[model samples]
Target: MTYWSGFCSLQKEVQPIELTKRQEMILQIVKDEGPITGEQIAEKLNLTRATLRPDLAILTMSGFLDARPRVGYFYAGKSGNQLLGEHVRKLSVKDYKSVPVVVKEETSVYDAICTMFLEDVGTLFVVKEGGILIGVVSRKDLLKSSMGNQDLQTIPVGVIMTRMPNIVRCTLEDSLSEAAAKLIRYQVDALPVVKEAENGGGLEVVGRITKTTITRAFVELGEEATV
Candidate 1:
């Protein structure tokens, strides 16, 4: 039997699922450049062919893609474009919350905690003396720091913060889908939303992007694009 047949057999034995990130990425790749082989898709994404086979199987079974004996996978029809477009649209950042809660790097940990409590937020973006995003502090970070012998009054917010490279951020133009993908892919609670400063320097955060924001936006839009 063929790949499609194999996938169908599996689906009959189990319920279908919405496409996952890896699956969605595979579909986008195939839809953009098809008549392509599984090996090719795996190579492009730095995935092993064995790892990608399951995703290809699900896509073919769901009718979003078709595989021939040798021609590889092709978009089954117009639904492919519509689905891809919707995915692209949802990923855009313009549709979601853009206001960020920020604190200076030198702010006391005690004061930061108060800010978090008053604002009812779990994380605080740390900005530099010049207003550039430099790091982030989560409630857990504060709790850990506060639990120790270090004095909260004397400790700078930067002392307990997760520094740059550890922090995740996105631009105002990024798609909600992309943000969600990063959140899951990186296993993080929130992303700092930043914009390039007019002076052409570092990122200036305009908002705090969270998974909740993406979920709410997705629900409001009511569009599902193959994961």
Candidate 2:
């Protein structure tokens, strides 16, 4: 039987639901031990019946917990045939394309632009003299540098690149959510995916993480994790 029948019968009208921490805690409690009552939950959590009422109401409304007049509350398994675990597993980053394009630090801005256009990407990784990532150059950066007196054909990317100490990077194993959060937090469109060098003094650009890459990965693989 549906767990929400009790609350539904009482309300008869639809209402909005907002789950708070306390409500979430209560839901966990019911999932762990129900056919249980709000009073039982309150007693276990050391909260009064009055204080637990709102939490119970919210949990019931949100479809996480269902209430019954006398049978108490119970954990409702996934609605219909949907499996929550399988749904989450399908959203993993392990199912997508993640290769990043890169370039050497000494390469000319002209070369970087050419690579960007040829690869149909917006950012290029700038590696050190040893093929370690030291910077990144975006299409806009090259365009800005080329708009004036700078000679794009002769100018090295390092001159206009977002260099070390300022470049934000992500590890190859970071979660897509975490990478996306960092990009949003830093206001950057791309991140260099790097690995620590064996000597422990530098990082090698193994790949690149960009918004477009993330989006495409999500669309193509049905996953959101991309770093």
Candidate 3:
């Protein structure tokens, strides 16, 4: 079956290509004398047309060179960073978000710590009955609460969690770049992904965006270039 793909598929099709020695020479030759045929380029390089075919194909496919019917190859004139930015901007938060680990506000700080360790997550979203977000608790928040003599089991997470209107969050529609910027600006490890609730209630937690998620996206981008 045929599956429809979005602009994100371009990430795989056009990567920040690393040109080889011969490929570099071919590109320079095209830049100097464009609208030149493959046969002509091969002649300039002192190689046969058959020998230069692979280099020519790589350049054309990577968007470094453009070819026309009988007109020959010309430079596409884009820098490496320009191409990288184009692919990265196409990624949306919805494509990379992970499932959220959440707890109710009434839960004790002790239980929250156990949940954080069990799930291997650094931040936990505190929600009401319908999964409506009310606050956010971090590893640091739990640690600070544990330091005091107050009974961890008795104190509710609501007492120490950073309540809403102050929590950093993103929505499914946000770009991955925007989410990354928030993480840096706030100096937080993760941002809860939220959306409007059906009954016009507060934002409801849907997913999460983290440093690891953005890192994985970039790593995939590099890997695709090699392939």
Candidate 4:
């Protein structure tokens, strides 16, 4: 069952099938004495099994109860963390990736360096004219290229970038855990989030994901689980 999420007053509209006074009593009986049979619960309440059947069915369908053909009913609270883990796994790159900082592969090294500073990013995605990803440049790469008294304005960044076929990337459909693993395994400051090109045979850079983004996601997840 799904919830009607809200910040406050979950008492009323949270459950689609709201429990009645009798149903609440039945739930407590099941919690206190389960893997118990329906007949046992009815006997404890001094009611007939037919009269309590509907309430049992409602609670089970609403996810407050679970029934097995031979094992009877048991509380489902123990599986809450498992459900939360599923939510984390379902998060995708598109939900967390930030806007990409991009520069043309042919852009002057001086301009690319300025773009990096202006964008406040440790890395920059290098793209061709049609926004197709071709290479990547980092601050360390720029520093190394500048050490020989080179003409930054005359040289294009493409000459100093980590070229295609070596770039570590992830698509938007990829899960957050997959992206996180790539971030750790590759030891890159950031990843270019891309999608298949409309014309095929290349990828178009759409966004970027970094360590900070994943950390923030962890913080949010913790806060939400606690709440």
Best by TM-score: 3
Candidate 2 local lDDT, 1-227, one digit each (tens): 46688778767665555567787788787766665777889998899999988777767767777654544676666442233233323333333326777887778888889999999888888876556877888888988988977778798988888888788888756666667777899988888777888888799766767788667744643332221
How well does each candidate superpose onto the true structure, as a TM-score? 0.59, 0.56, 0.68, 0.66
Give per-residue lDDT, candidate 3, residue 34: 71
Top-lDDT candidate index: 3
Q: Which is better, 1 or 4, measured by TM-score?
A: 4
Show model 2 residue runs off by greater than 4 Å. Answer: 1-97, 220-227
lDDT for model 4, please: 0.84
Error of 1 at 19 (Å): 35
Ranking under TM-score, best-scoring first?
A: 3, 4, 1, 2
Task: Report the lDDT tens digits of candidate 3 across residue range 1-227.
Answer: 22446556866777688889999999998877675689999999999999999999989988889775544676788555654565577678999999999999989999999999999999999999789999999999999999958899999999999998999999999999999999999999999999999998989899999999999999987876665
Q: After superposition, how far is residue 61 of candidate 1 from its true place, in Å?
A: 30
lDDT of 4 by residue, 1-227 (tens): 34545434566656466579999998897776665679888999999999999999898888888765534666666465554455567678999999999988789989998998888999999998678999999989998888887899999998999998999999999988899999999988899999989999699999999998889888877775555
**Lowest-scoring 10 consecutive residues by lDDT in candidate 3?**
1-10
How accurate locally, in lDDT, is each candidate?
A: 0.79, 0.72, 0.89, 0.84
The TM-score that candidate 3 achieves is: 0.68
TM-score for candidate 4: 0.66
Q: Regarding TM-score, does 2 or 4 come out ahead?
A: 4
Better of 2 and 3 by TM-score: 3
Q: Say which prediction, candidate 1 or candidate 3, comes out ahead on TM-score.
A: 3
